[model samples]
Target: MTEKAQNINLNKAKSNKKDEFYTQLSDIERELKHYKKHFRGKVVYCNCDDPRVSNFFHYFSYNFEKLGLKKLITTCYKSQDMDLFSTNNAERAIYLEYEGDKNGNMLPDASDIGIKQLNGDGDFRSEESIELLKQADIVVTNPPFSLFREYIAQLIDHDKKFIIVGHQNAIKYKEIFPLIRDNKLWLGFGFKGGAAHFINKHYEDYATAADRKEGMIRVSGVHWFTNIDLKKRHEDLILYKNYNPEEYQKYENFDAINVNKTKDIPIDYDGFMGVPITFMDKYNPEQFEIIGVGIANSGLEIGIQPYKPEHKYYRKEVQKRGAVNGDLYMMINGVVTVPYTRIIIKSKKL
Candidate 1:
């Protein structure tokens, strides 16, 4: 193989290694409880999960009767081996279907669940998995982080409802940003304390010793993304601060005022305001109107102007701070300052 091909394969191997992080059962139960009303008599599929190790499968199976679920379907990717991380050596994969407790044991047993083999590797994008997705009312899983865009696209293409785990950074993706703008997707009640501790045995835990748990990796900025309507999405964020020109700096390229922090968003500012991406966590469609993103290409598409010729000298300084031509920047204290990516929004009430 050529050097380029070898590098591609090596990168894929690294991504697959990162994909092995498992969702804790407690985390699954905590998020699923809020959506209980939507699951009655519905078929739920955990497409990117191994029934052997996936807490997604365990959560639904244990609560099958309680949720009034019609069926629970889980597909294992790339391996039939009973291990935490998939070996990905097997050509064929398997799926399991559990209706409920067959025996009087009130537990999901090997005999009770119907295990079946698949013709292809059980990728969420596989034709076999798509067929199963068509049968599901809800898709819940902690899919491979590297494939989040493709994974979400498939669910959207099939018009399937989903509650899946993903990094918060996915919100800024070109494909994903449009969905949030259109209100087709929103953040679910996220992990406790804005982070999650996922079960993993492969990667080294970088979390502090105080935060580390046995055989688990603490991932900050992870959240549940869902198309399902959530109560949290509708609640208005109570803004207390009043707008002041000194505190809220106007972007030179965009018409929006830049508010450095989400909590510092002004109650009286009715005009366009650019707030940090975390603002989405408390977003309410009824209370706020999402204008457009103030990132590179997204900013340009929304008519955010490029830097003036007179300010050309400061381009090098701004670029060093990671601000490109289309990103919103401002002249702060005679210095060109570029804030992090901001989501432009306007208060419907103000």
Candidate 2:
């Protein structure tokens, strides 16, 4: 498993409350900078946040007129108390709609916002939320981490435009990769340094080199996934490394060279090369063409010997080394070893 996959696994094993991380406003600001043009005259829905404290609400409501937004909507899950803020409120659920500052105060205040009670617990899948979704032009929120696939499916099903938060590893999901392959979805200007700090009220926290708070959990591999267009995504990567067999080892299971780092990509090589997932951050679709992943039987798979992960003999061979998940493999000589799931690419630069 890659470091990212392992971190996600550790989070899953330790926290059943995988969906509770609160996104910080600063992170939102950094990403929203590139999508301002899309919000004009558009209905932005924040289905997974509470307007009272949600930065999504604050960001949109505060800049409502400036962004030329037509409307803004926000909803929260069950009103059951998770903390003092969730307490002192009704036990059901609620939703809010704002049409920007009605008065001339230049702020979206109580008078400009509409608050309504919901019949359901405000589950995004509930009919009540679906009705609201139909009225939305764009959706934005950090949804339940564990239910990311389901949440994204709903948005795509509705054909809604959106900007949402998800882990970088989500790129490899069977349902997601096809969209990427077809250019239906792509990554946004990711959180600074491929990591984000979120508010975690349900558990104890510690400090990182980035923050000194106890309630904050720094999630690495966090990124912004969006269908919106941005100039940065088209910026080409400058490569200097030339293909050298001694440095770029060919994987035994696949007929391709293993590039341990993105920067080390061989500029002269015209063939397929397996590179790290981190390469996606600096990836420019106009420059490098993504082919496929390095999975067994994946259409891009190749070797003198075919890959068979389920073969009884192959399973036993991998078991002796360590836990073997769906990650791709590379053999050094005759020894079978796992490599991080690589994004197979046929360089356009070459």
Candidate 3:
């Protein structure tokens, strides 16, 4: 094999060998307990995992047998490692062949009802995977960070109940944020601190060197986004404080100020309602509501402004041309000019 291929293989080997370093946290355990009760005598699927190194198995193996799970499905792209941990009640659990591995010959135990190996990926998007998703009462696993968006889309599309692990920033995505806003999702308990170790194939010596020093493969704080009950563990942090119309009138150049009110405000306003960033979390169609949200700088006009660079040459050219008044500038990416303004809006219902 080529050197690159050899390296990839070596990395996979190392990850498999050291997989035990990763462990589930208490909050994850609590969530699983809730799941077991809710999905008693139902099938559960763990997508994007090796049965041996899977967080799903680590957390739920004992509980599965106790609850008499109908089936536990796990997959691997290359080899089946489901035999690492043996459960006494093997008859109840079944292993199916993933369709992607045509040559894979792993078979489920006789006690298992049947085999259902089919095509799938770390992202869990295959016909069999979709079928498993449809059949499962709950999906619990740590999906690959690379394809988190697509993975979430599948769950939401199917309207399945799931408790999955992902980067905390996933909550900030435009697509994801709306779900939390609409009360279709919520952040789990123990989100403030983060979760356990995640040993992986790409353990770069330098890129992850700092995290290594800290004794873990640290990604951004891992959080649980779910339609399941999270028990409202974390205290809600307010986004806006001391909000008043007079405080914002001076910065009228901006379009609006986003404020998160601690207490619910009256929605009986004639104008638009500017919900705070926190409003994204509590937004409910039946109760609270959202009109719209975007970049609105009250100080400057809603157009862009371009200024010459601070270099000596640029400054000289600017002096020669005289200071140009506000030139229309192209807003790129997340950068935007906001007037000393706050998001303002009117609310009615509550």
Candidate 4:
């Protein structure tokens, strides 16, 4: 491989190694509680979880009867150990199936659960795992961050309902944004304080001293992506700010007034407005129409044009900071400034 290709592969491997954060039971329960109604009589699959230590397995098995679930299936990638995190050390992997409480003890018992080995390494993309996925009604798991795009595409291609975890930045991805724009997927009731505390062993904690916990990694911008509809999805955001030309700067390349914060979105403005990515959290289709994203390629798709020739020097300056053709920019005090990633939307009600 060329040096560039080798470097990319190395980086991907490093990223996948750091993608082993285990979901906390409290975090799972908090988000699942909001969707209990959707779980009734459904076959739930935790394809990325090891039944031995995964809280996703624990939560579903424990709540199978409570949720009136038809079945609970969990599969581990490779490791068979009961360790805090899997290192994928084993050549083969296993899956588990639980059908409520067979002994009537009101709890999932090991004797009642069925454990089976896979011919393959139990990767979610493996044919054996895909067979299990076909039988499931809802797939729930914390998938690997590095493989998130492919993982989501697989779920979409299979037409399977899912509530999977991923970084919030995935919303802007070319592969993912179209799904959100078309209402095929959406954000779930996210982690507390917009960050998650995951059980982990291989990474150092970068959380503040006040937020740090023993044996856990605090990852910001993590969110649950799901096709299952949420009650909050239809609730309109309470916008209090009124639009003013001085407060909201109009982008020079795109005809949209930029609002730095979601909460500050103007209620009166009916035209296209550019807002931060966090706006997705409060987006209600009835209240606003998602125009398009305002980043390079997506920006061009939404009609964002190149900088005028008169400001070529300014464009060159901003390009050094990662700006490119079709990026949305505006003059702030006579200086060319490219705004951070923005989602263009229009107020439907206004």
Candidate 5:
């Protein structure tokens, strides 16, 4: 099939699938209502979404209007019907059908409100998207799972506020865990019971018996992530697992521990304090102290060896010889590195 023809088909398929997902919105309406209450009188951006298929639209569109939301910006991979959200007031609602190239390359137009759509895959990694993010007060959408890292990073980089949907495992992503550790973000109220309804790939409302249902399948757990306050509307469950002292003692020199997977934590240790990566947001410098981090890789060590002054003078001589050199020197330890997991020392108060 031609690229245009395929795009048309894909657009239809996505629209249908999103419509099916909307059927489940009623189950989550109460929580969504609370989420929307926080966005009253605010400009909301829904990137990588069609309003019809979006929970943000299905649940909060009316509330947004009632609360005097200044604007509602929604975009799709291709221009399609968005009449469902059309209101008489142009200031309150606007929809854009992003046009992509023959190869499916598209960017968010200058008129586009929030992050510029880059690569047209619905991920928020484009330069324009980052710029739009700077203006946003809150983002509400179900972003593509593949680009959750980049999406969250852009939000953090610009310090933009957002409410996004993703998988539960996203809490364990090396990049995401730190945000929680530093108290910059936290988990939403949902996903406490372990399973949520997501529209299946066959466009079924729920998982069918015939679906493969294996690792990284199309059908998976859908979670909500946001920095917005839900106003004490959540059930208190142990979001962070407790650290086992037995386990910490076994891993010496580790002052504190964050158990992304509580069940997998080691056994037998002293002074090993455990908390979930979500605790990053709750991290108190007076309570728990971070010591150091470790990375497990041989190739990285080998690649930087030449730049080490003690190992050889090749790196220094290249600069001295004017071999297109700059102030690039590889050091063994002075540099600060970000780690997936770090051992922190807990204060007596915590």
Candidate 6:
């Protein structure tokens, strides 16, 4: 699709309010396997989940004793935690608190679950939820994607460790990038194939070419963001490319060289290189220093490359090599456009 058409679709998606993406149990196990050790004796809050269908609750409750969790709390948006096909009869938001099985059964059964009403609608920002947040040691949930920024801010504000799902595109957000740049957050083991198939009661089926299940929507560009450290965050990305000015050209409006692909980062180059936002998944804090991000009118203290839909993307060819007058833009065959969101960086000693 043309850049202009893509932007129109993206704009519509940005304002869209369809945020009911139910994560499958398999996806939970994929990432949570690495975090089991952190949950011991800690209260886990799946504050944005529906206890009736939340795999998060399902997983933790079943593994509560194994993980040494003190308690498991789940809050649902409004009163929508009933059977998927049930008619609406409730008006108040609700929550469920599980303190593990009381009997010798060692299983988290429905009889042992305690369901309660919330004084508010259970928005994660509600005072009641904030009180619960204060009680939690770790927050884990697939929050509403549209509110990812606000949701993550709340967690960071409370200094809570979290494992949550959001779009990979969020890495460029002003509120999010600084956290990554400062090493306060990093991407978790992302969704397989960089796409997630989510279930929803509202959508019938998107019928996309990826994995399409009944009542499911396939969303690409999804990733998990967290504060917890992982082994991948410390591993170095092997570099093999050498700098060639003909292939690595400067941006039309920025001073940094444009790296079309992360693997193509040259070992000999030391200056700032603007790599794709996906670089976060493979980012090793020890190997590269995150300088900043570049976007159109970002005014980010680092650099800015304003997004222009009319411009076409070119591969390894430059129309012009821009100067440092602060207004230089990289052109390809005389066509100028904004590059994709990039995570600015420079390599460390090999």
lDDT tens digits by residue: candidate 2, 1-350 = 34645465436534444334667889899899889988999999998777777888899999999999999999877743222122224477889999988789999879889999899888788999999999999999877666778888999999998899888778887778778766788889888767776776554443355454566666668788888878878887788888989888886555778899999998899988889878877778878888876654443433324445554255466555542333456656655666777888887765
Q: Which stretches in model 2 have alpha-carbon errors above 4 Å?
A: 1-19, 79-90, 206-212, 296-319, 322-327
Candidate 3 segments exceeding 4 Å error: 1-27, 33-36, 65-68, 79-123, 190-197, 200-215, 233-242, 245-255, 259-350
Better of 4 and 5 by TM-score: 4
Taking the tens digit of each residue's C-alpha lDDT, what string does model 6 give over 132-168? 9999999999886667889989999999999998877
Say which candidate scores most in lDDT.
4
TM-score leader:
4
RMSD of each: 4.9, 3.9, 11.2, 4.4, 13.9, 5.2
Determine which window of 10 residues in candidate 5 has minimal summed lDDT. Answer: 82-91
Cα lDDT of candidate 3 equals 0.47
Q: Report the lDDT tens digits of candidate 4 across residue range 1-350.
A: 23244334324434454535678999999999999999999999998788888898989888888899999999988965422223577677999999888788898888989999999988889999999999999999988666788899999999999998887888999999999888898999999988888776656666779999988767677789999988899999998989899999999988899999999999899899999988998888888989898887888987999768756566667555555777788988887887778999998896
What are the TM-scores, per candidate, against the unseen true structure?
0.91, 0.87, 0.56, 0.92, 0.52, 0.85
lDDT of 1: 0.83
> What's the lDDT for residue 259 in model 6?
88
Identify the runs in model 4 with alpha carbons over 4 angstroms from their true place: 1-19, 80-87, 309-312, 315-319
In candidate 6, stretches whose alpha carbon ends up further than 4 angstroms from where it belongs are 1-19, 81-90, 204-210, 303-329
Cand. 6 Cα-lDDT = 0.77
| TM-score: the better of candidates 2 and 6 | 2
Residue 79 accuracy (lDDT) in model 1: 65
User: Which of candidates 3 and 4 reaches a greater TM-score?
Assistant: 4
Candidate 2 vs candidate 6, lDDT winner: 6
All candidates in order of TM-score, best leading: 4, 1, 2, 6, 3, 5
How far residue 46's Cα lies from its native spot in candidate 6, in Å, is 0.5
Lowest lDDT 10-mer window, candidate 1? Answer: 1-10
